[model samples]
Target: MRMTTNANRRVTDEQIERARSIDLVQFLQQYEPPGELKRIGQSWTLKSHDSMRISADGRWNWFSQNKGGGDAIGFLQAVHGMSFQDAVRTLAGEDFKTIPTTQAEHKAKPPERAAFALPPKNNGNRRVFAYLHRSRGIAAEIINHCIKNDLLYEDAQHHNAVFVGKDENHNARYAFLRGTLTASHFRQEATGSDKSYGFFLRGSGKTLFVCEAAIDALSIATLRKFDGLDWKKDNYLALGGVTASESKLPAALERTLNTFSFKRVVLCFDNDAAGQTAARRIFTMLRQQFSENLEVQTCVPKVKDFNDQLCVKLQNGKNSPSRGTRESTLSR
Candidate 1:
């Protein structure tokens, strides 16, 4: 049966109902090109020239443009320039030939550039260095090394520890900010931060150490230093926390594997439920994705995380010249 509709033809109640019942996300997944759609939290963001986001409830809004959302039909009308009759017919599985053209249109456009920007920088990372070196038990030399290399800093506005992730071109593509205050849980990604470029400490070793936060990564480096190992010779990466969603590996790890050669991939996430779950998921994923030549292993922190473990070790008069000394004495 051929379904034909003119602009003047009225869509039946059954047609409208059927179109509305179609799952918008599933429909887009089936029809849209890969990487054009991204799920952030409970909402789905359409990666267009103007950044449009659609909620799970079928409402959408374009941030860069002056546009609000509507039903699935409205989505087609707004985004694809489809008329009401065509939108409904498309949703009802009657007009499927245009999907190829729509996908091609999206693909022909230029890729989205990383409009990454860091927050205001202070005169010096005094508070951040103190927080990491004193409170977080990270070595001062490690903090200084990162600061000198433009990989970390303190935001002038809120004294937040800003960990920067750079691209292969040495451009800042991601910034993960955490408050310096000991009691604060304030942390956020800078606007337009790209997760594919994660904050990392480059090393010469074949083994890659992964952590849940920048502080944990630094803590691991500190631990490596105390063990008399050349800390800078080992790769350290913070994943910005592990993802629970059963998708492919996070952009950071995937990007690393593609860009750098590595034999051993270590999962050094926190020793908690979420971290453990993420480690297991990543372990299985890496094993399946790579051949047996790649060694995927999980090395959970002795405590909650590397930072906590470092603090406990330091307090217990371990690997320190003096007992109960909280401040880092490593030459900066």
Candidate 2:
């Protein structure tokens, strides 16, 4: 077993907790992984990764993408000049030698996503994920990995959601606004906020995670790139917005049972007040739906949220090479 002396601990709950409270300082607490990288946000400009700012808000605001230099093996490998495997071992402590890297030791993964159900017309823009990757000045591997596994949302209701199909010019166009299905109205709610409805990524789900916003789900997808995780086999749905609505929560729980043969549901939400409240409510609904078969766990970012984190990480100074961070008049 790898044991660390009191002096070796890199992060502490108190520090992490403090970081979570302020959106400004959230990005700097990312040292959990030795291979961890940082990105800039839209709100921040002109700061380089090396000279990144930690605003009073506790966010790790970054510099321009051009300024955020690439590091080896993440910053860890760069500092240590080791191969990725050795860098991983460096982080693993003594477990480096004994821990099996065998394929057999790895968890048995679900089947790969063979059929990707692109919206007959979907119009969500994802250059944001890529923008975030570049702003943090993350490595090419990190950026490429995220782009490859981006998830498409298939289950959000109308008014708050729009579906897009292609125009004759091959440009993406909005197809229609969705209405509340019979399935939509049949759930529990706390504050009666229909704004927070449970969503499914792809209906025939097997493994699923739930969060509060489409942005949060996308953020999780962005984070998955760094963690060497995949979200396609593992699906994520957003509950629309941050309101204490339980109306759609139970509906999702039941579908998780009947429509999805899913074994797991991870509730990845913001690490703040609203998220905690919503997660608790959703948990109660889930327990009643499956009793034992459904397993519920919560995922929280040490900072603001998946999107908030990414948004901050990908701000490469005032502007990137192309669709860079929008130059705000307030920034000037």
TM-score, every prediction: 0.65, 0.38
User: Please, what's the RMSD in Å of model 1?
Assistant: 12.2
lDDT (tens digit, per residue) of candidate 2 on 123-164 = 442333333334333334433443333322223222222322
C-alpha lDDT score of every prediction, in listed order: 0.73, 0.39
Q: Positional deviation of 72 in candidate 1, in angstroms?
A: 22
Q: Can you give the lDDT of residue 102 in candidate 1?
A: 66
lDDT of 2 at 331: 12
The list of candidate 1 runs beyond 4 A from truth reads 1-114, 321-332
The reply for model 2, stretches above 4 Å from the true place, is 1-200, 203-205, 245-257, 311-332
> What is candidate 2's TM-score against the reference?
0.38
State in Å the error of residue 325, model 1: 18
Residue-level lDDT for 76 in candidate 2: 33
